[model samples]
Target: MKYSTSPTPSLNNYPRSTSPLPAPANYQPTTASAAVKRYKYIRRLFKFNQMDFEFAAWQMVYLFVSPQKVFRNFNYRKHTKSQFARDDPAFLVLLSVWLFLSSICLGLAMTLTAGKVALFVLFVVFVDFIGAGVVVSTLLWYVSNKYLRRDQDGPDVEWGYAFDVHINAFFPPLSLLHFFQIVLFENVLFRETFLSCLVANSFWLASIIYYLYITFLGYSNYGKLVDSDLPMLQNARVFLLPLPVLVLSYLATLAMGWNLSEMLMHFYKMRVLQ
Candidate 1:
């Protein structure tokens, strides 16, 4: 967070990097399918020394404050490594660790038993984060290549990149609903008053909004590389297809007097109980 007396590259035309990052060791700019790249990426999971966690931490910080700057690196990766998906597993590893820690904190705040807390953490880290991530990423990957792309012959959106987008978008929401929401859960969000419902659901609304915006940003920048001639691309908000439905759902939740945080607490307890 320290200001440096250094000039960084401008974010305009970032996808076309003027100063690309130095490629990782053993990296080569080659056109490869996401599946193949994922195979190589997974192999490095156990190798702790090669991961750049400091850079990952920096990226995480910017993701909250200035997500645009964070994604500029993704474009740089494509410039140097021929793919938008990251090669290092450091970010994924850190996210999982954060997810685990946050889940524990949430479970404890809910006053669950130690065994139940363990079960809740397991469900969150595995089911909510990893399992659901695969489904969302695969769905977006399919949609981008099928409908979003100009044609079958054009460069397809990589599946790994779709997953990256999902995780990148997922981080802020997780911090909001999991970390920040839980911090306020015991005092504010778990109540049954109208204010409680509004505040709790507002967090839900904001979290989903953050997710959608970041997801759109991920695809929007990529869309610039592909054919942006579609009539929808006239406005800069071309990728925000879900905002209306999201707003409607948020309104419905408020009208129904649902406390989303309380619901989350009950859901976690139910998951552990069963």
Candidate 2:
């Protein structure tokens, strides 16, 4: 009855408010905060927690003291299915520390200027990280998935699984050698001696062999999809699966001219001021 003469209140009369809402008291700008958060995230990403440290230590012991146990007990497929789970980060952290220390020791041995030493170490680490960690790992995964898959019949092995197996099998011994090279053989006489080089190469070769053996075991457990009667062929195929990685590693080293002793000597000769 009150609307008798009034035009029906049109919906258009209720104009919507365009004013922006005030920022919440707790809502801080994400610009600096986002960067800080990202920095923290990256730091945390690379940081080794206690669990990681303990696992890495245990891995070293298992790899060095009882490699067979490692192959027998460690389940590569189960761990690697989730990509970068389990010992992946641990291995990376260990490798990074090893690389850093080894580079420092090598720089000192080479008597290089501090700047040169830093540059050289950075270069070597960069090259190695790219070559072994990225390129060779990718190649191994491809070879395993594309070619080696035919040899096995179990679950379809993912590239991450192969990559994990490769890293675990290879890096432990390598890291040990890196430690030894820096700690025990830092002197010029040791660096120059043929025995030292021979021993180093011998250990390197042994590590490679051990990696192949571990990879063989991993394949035996996960990759072998064939009938029970053909176990030998399955074994052989698994054994050979890592050959591609080996070849790639060798090629990479050659291409990069990555000789630890040479690198040490090159820097030593620089004799850059401290």
Candidate 3:
């Protein structure tokens, strides 16, 4: 009996089956493209998560030292968005280390020059630089985030985590400067020279005004994601909202010091008149 059998399969021209199809030929993934693709995917998946404070802190420190980075991101939309998204705890910790190191070095330098009149001037100048830092920190985030809004896909919201991160990181520098000006100077340098006290007074006054302005601005615009959403600046009195009672309380203490000084001067004048 002749049984018809299927023609023997030929090795040539027959499709070879493997465990799985090899990745397509002509699918060339260069490193740059892969990185870019990865970045985009990560950005979308990113959330403030539990690490938001840490991320935001690093961003503040990074942007503080490298204004150029913020500026570049301002010009480039992708960078701004990526930056805003990846803000996480690990990054903030690194930044805190850097800011802490910076603060320590500044404090040490101040310590080394503790008793010198020239040191007082340097301290005064240093305080001014600290004030500048505050302005720059606030400005970099405000501007970078503003630029990010240009092509935003959804409603703009303040990354509260980032804002908090910044506040936490920023408070250190501000507090350090305040300590140097108030306690350090008052205890050591103020009695040395009239000029020293005058400079310290100016620094203190400037600091008070600066703090009030920044605090007011922070609360007034705290939840405002858009410019139009801002309450009328004149009518809103947004400044009163952030409980600056602590700051106000501090101011009251200073006022009492001034009043006591005035009373002493008045008593001295009466004695001379008698």
Winner by TM-score: 1
Model 1, position 226, has a per-residue lDDT of 26
Q: What overall lDDT goes with each candidate model?
A: 0.78, 0.53, 0.40
Candidate 2 has its poorest 10 consecutive residues by lDDT at 224-233
Which 10-residue window in model 3 sums to the lowest lDDT?
A: 18-27
Pull out the clashing pairs in model 2.
110-268, 111-268, 153-225, 154-225
Give the per-residue lDDT of model 1 (tens digit) for 1-274.
9898888768774543344333232133467766788888999889989999999999788888888777666765764678778899999999999999998898889888899899899899889999999999999888777777655664677778899889999999999988987776558776779889988889889998888888887876662322222311123265577789889988998899978888878877887898
Off by over 4 Å in 3: 1-98, 109-191, 225-227, 230-274
Error of 3 at 125 (Å): 23
The regions of model 1 sitting more than 4 angstroms off are: 1-16, 19-35, 223-239
- The TM-score measured for candidate 2 stands at 0.57
Per lDDT, the best of the predicted structures is 1
Cα error, residue 76 of model 3, in Å, equals 14
Q: Judge candidate 3 at residue 61 and give its lDDT.
A: 56
TM-score of each: 0.83, 0.57, 0.33
133-229: candidate 2 lDDT, tens digit per residue:
6676676566555665544543344444556566667665556455565576545325446555555554455667776776665555442212222
lDDT comparing candidate 2 with the true structure: 0.53
Clash count, predicted structure 1? 0
lDDT of 1: 0.78
The lowest-lDDT stretch of 10 consecutive residues in candidate 1 is 225-234
